[model samples]
Target: MPDECVILADGPAALVELCGISTLERLLRTLQRCGITRAIILSSSAAEIARRLARPSWARADLEFTIHERPPGPTTVQQIVDLWPEAAARLLLIQGDVVFDIRLLRTLLAQTSSAMLIDSSAPETNRGKLCGAALLQREWAVARNGSVESALLEGLEQHTAEALDVANQPLYDPGLRRNLRPICFPAPALANKQAAERVLFDSVQKGTLDFPAWIHAPIEKFLLRYLCRTSITPNQLTISWAIAACLTTIFFATGHLIWGIVLALVVGILDGLDGKQARLKVETTAGGKIEHHLDSFFDVVWPIALAFHFYSSGRLPTAFYYLVVLLAGEGVDGIAKAIIYSGAGRLMTRSICATHRRPAKYLHLGVGHRADSWSAGKGSNCDGVVGIDDCCNRHSASSTDVDLAPKNTLVDQLTINPVGLVLGCADRFDEAVYHNVVFERHAELALEAAAYALFHYLQNKRLGNAGAAILSQNAERNETHCANFATIVEQLD
Candidate 1:
């Protein structure tokens, strides 16, 4: 991948704001995240953009951000190259008007020395017209009159095979993603956008939302509409919700069920906003761990408060017994989850993050089959979802997912090379290339080996569902999403 980029900052769309930030700023952040070391901005309105754009303070300290208030002409190109000879090696040139998915950049970076982004879904008239981005080398000569748009069109030669291809594909189809879906990003660049605002909200949405959160989505969106316009930050929302949680406990302890229920529902909905606002505005913090403990504390406290209310109001004769049962169940569940997370730590985290952090609505043992059923991985999401290595393919791919076991089939093939385990060690910073080891003949040993491999990795990611996030950004590093587990209140409702 190219380490540097040249963004042509121009046009009204370049200044378009989404989630309280402009497109230029968003692109810069994305670039920094994707490992861009140096960036040169060519814009007539460079000074104006600097005034309006709020660049991220957390961006790489070593990243060079240079702005030139001119078009991409021979003089300008020569000036950039003379100052930085590394530009001769390779660099990506992007138009400021085009807000794109990072995957497109990744795809372009994977190409040989030079390539341009191709939007197969683009209209016929705009086919040769710039998709507004290209990976370039010093081999291409810049004319005296050249603009950023003309840089990609330097030669009449059209090369599409090695470059990025945005095939016209169904957004939900994971099979088509093998082509890398250059244009068909899980969160498509800014496709189908009236304003990037709606897309920003849509991008943060998960596949399986529990009932309360399902109910809360639109209400919070309405609230977010105003929140995005303000100076209020994510930590502020977190603090507000924490304060509201205390108020909820007070109402419940006072034996006011109606007020408690209303307030609790309000708090549950607002609980989602802080993270949403944080992501949309790119303001996530490490102090979020404090928020996690507070949430867990409230989760335990709220139920106790409700039980106390039931007893005080004489709403139930067996309220004390019910409270005991609730505490016992919570204790058992928490311990089991902790064990699972600790034991299957790396395997589960890598698998889940690879599948785009969408919590599973369905949990299956094997790739495509349900826990109650059995079938070879076909006519389902087996092929595209599981990263089956040579070991599994040589014998059987019966057990590829975490947290599940087959009832009928247990094909044990242990006399194979540990390619998956080896691949898992290759990139310590990335999601594991492989994560499963199933032994029907010896389930305990399988679990132990898997546990040991996973435990050593110990990434902070939590375990999630199998093949659940196939249609989303599988293996998107550093994506922080709150798990919306079903609560007793939501379940009852």
Candidate 2:
């Protein structure tokens, strides 16, 4: 049980920034989260690092951060022992470049004896490549005179070392062996940057809508990593994209089709970036609220503007009527979604009941009527019992149970499926739903755009113009799509 952690934050790698935060800052934050009250940061330029960390934004009032200049020759363990003799009894060693999960670190610290954190999933030869973190007892660090890895290996050989299985944990090692770059770093900083982007990417939520955009994920991730080094906030990005979307609408209205298409594509990419940046930076809820409203505004206004443009050009006569239909469909969609989420509590209760029923089946198969005996009067009466008393009790208990049952409150409901429950406290079911709905809406808009493009294509034909007929057919198709979505709402009702 380490009372304090010693971070070896010496080298260019320690200064590497991710999501606008330095590796040392990230490490300190993780240690704070793990409830480590004290830490000593050993760096070659201790004063410079300490000065940089003195900013009000980087302040951690609870944890005491001390910086020490790294000695010229001795190993990190040996230096720690020579400098802070008291911390030798229970010292936690962390390599400054390694980006890891706080939960994993806390789990490692829970061990009773000295332990080395290893990724078991790595190849047998690579398994010895520890993730730059280890728990060492006091005696283990005394007079150690090599690299941290070498010292850890010697300690393991000399003592009964417990290997902390970090195979499934989110541990990013940017050491000599496992250098995850491009996604984690730019071309120049590939060797030095901590693999924080890899950890952040792993943390990204995959929603129902995520599959359609899977092709663009790598591009978005690349751009996100690049943008993270900049001082731009996520909300600022959202505002910029909103302005671009508005410009896109203007371009469509002015009949600049190429500019409109280009801006629309840019808007789409920025839309993805805003959310990605927000999640990575842990932006405020107000930022997300602003994003949602902007998206909703764009979703309705963009198509309406395009339709108006077509009507003004004498391409489609019933554009206003089509706009009306679109608005009505969107209203119906909103109402339907609200109703569905409202009933989620009842559905969740039934789901829980179903889950509880499985064990009773197993118990019945194993113990027969004896299971019934224990459950007879205790309100566990499921079905098919043969006594008059049981029948009477079942009937009489049903009403009382219904009356006494916990109310199906909205708070108890989970909007997403059971698999989403695995996210536990980090579950953003509403956010997922919003993203899915936006994707579906975007798909509808794409279909409409295709229809408009087809109308133009037909009008340009040398022999005959079938633009009116094509537009009419597209209008009917759009209506059909709306009706199909409405039918889903009806079914849910």
Each prediction's TM-score versus the true structure: 0.57, 0.47
Off by over 4 Å in 1: 35-38, 54-64, 71-90, 102-116, 123-130, 134-161, 167-196, 285-293, 308-320, 328-493
Write one digit per residue (lDDT tens) for candidate 2, span 83-127: 555635677888776666554575566544577676655534334
CA lDDT, every model vs. true structure: 0.51, 0.51
Index of the highest-TM-score prediction = 1
Over the stretch 1-493, how does candidate 1's per-residue lDDT look in tens digits? Answer: 4656788776556777766666777677667656687888777777876766535455334456887776433334554354345536667777666666654554455444466766655533344334766776555533323443444454324432223345421122111111123332221245545445676676554443367766888888888888977888888888889888899999888887788888888788778888777666655555765877888899889888888878878887678798889889988989997877445523542343232232222222233322222244323332121222111222322223333222222333111111111011111112222222222222112333433333222221223223221111112242211111110101110
Report the alpha-carbon TM-score of model 2 versus the true structure: 0.47
lDDT of 2 at 238: 82
